[model samples]
Target: MTFRRQVMIILRRDLRIEGRSGEAIFVTVPFGLVALFLIPLALPLDIELLARIGPGMFWSVTLLFGMFITFRQSAAESSSQQEQLRMLGVDPAARFVGRAIASALLLLIFELILAPTMVVLYAPAAIPGWPAIIPLALLAAVGLAMIGTLAADITASLRSRSALAPLLVAPLSVPLLVPAAQGLESLRTKNGIMVPTMFMVAVVLALAVAGVVTAQPLEETT
Candidate 1:
């Protein structure tokens, strides 16, 4: 099969497996809700503090939850002999892209479920131009997906690797997350609107490129 076709086949198979197992939602959704719920409880009932920090909290939680989910999802490969199958004929680059795409889709699903919950629990007034939040969410999720997928691929096999994915992904993710928090916080503070968007876009593109480039090594290792 052509390389693109092979990649698509891998994506389809992963999707089918996730659909059958229902592990995708089971893993991401609950954590997302917990994240939303915790923000309120952790901070004192000060409305100002909650409003000031809510977006950063929500974004961070969503990104983190997505990373954990992606790690588990990608690590599932080791549970079977699929890694060996890919070792033979598969183009490692294509496989990496395919896995990244699959993880992005899962992260998107988690965002849809989590964002509204965050808004409801924390109140939408905290975020100005609340409808414009979609781009921010998408940008953050994509960045997380890139970092998470790459980390997952790298750490899929070793018994302790799953624990390591977050350790690695989180530090690499801060550059992306800081801007995301700033962007959302700006929306909250009614400050400059453009800064976060610019930073987020840059981080998103950079992480995507890094993920694709780094995935090859992990693919070979797997």
Candidate 2:
């Protein structure tokens, strides 16, 4: 099969499984919402304070819960299922991209739902720069998805993968978190987002390259 075909098949298969399970929508998203809802309660009831910190809080929650979405599908796969894909001659790089894309889509949904909730709850003084917010969210989603996918792959064979995956993902995801928070803050401040936006793009590109390069070796090891 062609690489593109392999990617599509894997992507479709993963999405189908997630759709049926509703783990991302029903489970992860709610927990994320709850987390976001509780943040302001923990802080002083100062609206300005909440507004000022809202963007950072939103991105922080996203990075935390988004990692779970990346691992959710992979953790559900059995050894037999993985071996079956290998037996069918699926390319490891294609598998990597396919899973990353699926994770990215799910994370995008998570971010979309949380964005409005944050806005409603925090009510920041400045209107969000939707023009910048849209692409910033997309880039953040892709970057987090890539980080989570690679971390899941690295820990796939471990008995402690559940614990280890988060450790691996969180530190590595600093590049994504800092720039994403900065971009959102820039939106509020009317500051140009070029530097942070470019940094996020670079992080996504770097992760994509790293994922493709390491996929085969990781597959072989596992």
Candidate 3:
């Protein structure tokens, strides 16, 4: 099959599984929302303080919860299933892209649901650059998805993957979390978001390239 076709096929298959299972929406998303909701309760009831720190909290929870989605995507496919794909001539790069795209779409939905909740609970002051949040969220989702995919693949064969995957993903994802948190704070404070925003874009591109290039080798090793 053509690379594009392979990617589409894999994407459709993963999405279909997620649609039937509702793991991302029904399971991961609720826990993420609960985490978001609890942050305010843990902090002093300072509305201004909550508003100031809310974006950072949102990104932090997203990164934590998103790891589960990516790990599950990689772990759901059995050895037999992977061998079946190889037998059917699926390109490793295409498989990686397809899975990453699916994870990104799911993470985007998670972020969308959390964003308004953050706003409602924290009541961050309105700012002129509010619209910029859309792209920031997109960039963050793609970056996290790519990080999680690569991490999952690296630990796919390990018995301790559930513990190790987060270790691998968390440090690598600092670039994504820091910029996303800072970008929103900058917007709230009326500071320009160019630097952090561009940094996040660059990180996402780098992770994408790394994920595609390592797909074949990672598949072989696992």
What lDDT is obtained when candidate 1 is compared to the true structure?
0.73
Superposition TM-score, candidate 1 onto the true structure: 0.85
Encode model 3's per-residue lDDT on 21-138: one tens digit a residue.
Answer: 8888778899899998898898888989998787778889999876688887433688889899988989999999999999999999898898889889888777785788678889
- What is candidate 3's TM-score against the reference? 0.94
Query: For residues 27-126, could you state the per-residue lDDT of candidate 2 as single tens digits?
Result: 9999999999888888878988998888788899999987799999533567788889889999999999999999999999999899889888887656
Order the numbered candidates by TM-score, best leading: 2, 3, 1
Selected candidate, larger TM-score, 1 vs 3: 3
Worst 10 residues of 2 by lDDT: 124-133
At residue 123, candidate 1 shows an lDDT of 63
Write candidate 1's Cα lDDT for 8-68 as tens digits. 9778877777787667678667977887887788778887677556666777887677787
lDDT of 1 at 215: 59
Clashing pairs in 3: none
- How far off is residue 151 in model 3, in Å? 1.1
Record all residue pairs in model 2 with backbone atoms less than 3 Å apart, i.e. clashing: none
Clash totals in order: 0, 0, 0
What is the TM-score of each predicted model, taking all chains together?
0.85, 0.94, 0.94
lDDT, candidates in the order shown: 0.73, 0.86, 0.85
